[model samples]
Target chain A: MEWFIAKIFAKYNYWISIILMMIGFYGIVAKDNLIKKIIGLNIFQTAIFLYFISLGAVKAGTAPIVDAEIIRKGYVYANPLPHVLILTAIVVSVATTAVALSLVIRMHQEYGTIEESEIIEKSRDKGMTWT
Target chain B: MIVSIDLILLFFVVVIAIAAITLRDLLSAVILLGAYSFLMALIWVELQSVDVGFTEAAVGAGATTAFLVATISRTVRWEKK
Candidate 1:
């Protein structure tokens, strides 16, 4: 029991990320409004970013920026690779969100509503068949 | 000490997330989401990923919020019951 407690305490960050992931997943799956779904998607992406960054953390580490004295002491520095990759991911996320929102706007123009069920109903009313 | 603070921030993030989804007003939800992104950026900084945090603050909180608000303005601001 003590060992289990020790392990859990040491790895609490992972648990927090998992909880966040579940919340985002629920938002994406259960929400009916298009904007809410998009918000959920963003939350999901943020959770993944958090998980990746937590993975890169080193105990007693400083930021990855270089300094001679730090090198001389053999101090650990946080991994730069995940930071670089997540930077790219953030850019991609922004672009994706822009495109998605634009598409939502277009859909709203067509269907006259942003609710998923309403869109379906409107399309069906217009004699549009869903496969 | 830092771990405790991170945990508390994580709890707040979850609460804000729930509020963002459950709120009735679309505008409120969008604003809450922007707040969520800002908090997430802070968490990244706490985790020692300053670059990611900076990018998140700009892209997640700033650009994303602007994009969402603009879209909302062009479209409807309330979800149908």
Candidate 2:
């Protein structure tokens, strides 16, 4: 029972992250505005980042800082690989957001509105084939 | 991170995300996204990823907000009903 409390119950980050991910997914799928959809995508990505970072935590472990004393003490270092990967992923996410927002800007300039449904309707009205 | 702090941060992040999606003004939503990114950075630092938190704070909150503002300025602010 104590082990359960110490292990499973201590790892609560995963469940909340799942909920957050769903909210982002909902935004991407259901929102009418392109910006809102993009916001949702950001939210979803953040949630994934949270989950991945959480997975890197070690029980009774310290941060992955290399110190001679700590090494002699044999302290367990939390996995640093996920942290590095997520760092790169965050940058990529920002780059992706920039590109996606620029596309929205173009869509707005052409269609005069950023709503997904309206853009589709306007494109069809203009006789442009949008697959 | 303290469990209580972690819970509070997570709760606020979730609330802000919901607000960001539901808000009508694109500018306000963009601002909320900046706030969201800042909170996410704090969460990362708490998770022992200080480097990731720094990138998120600088790029996610900073550059992303700038790009969003530019896009909004060049396009529109309010979502049409």
Largest lDDT belongs to which candidate? 1
Looking at model 1 chain A, report the run of 10 residues with the lowest lDDT sum: A12-21
Best by TM-score: 1
Over 4 Å off in model 1, which ranges? none
Q: Candidate 2, residue A5: CA error in Å?
A: 9.6
| Per-model TM values vs. the true structure | 0.96, 0.92
Output the lDDT of residue B76, model 2: 80
DockQ-based class of model 1: medium
Provide the TM-score of chain A alone for each candidate, in the order shown.
0.95, 0.89
RMSD of 1: 1.3
Off by over 4 Å in 2: A1-9
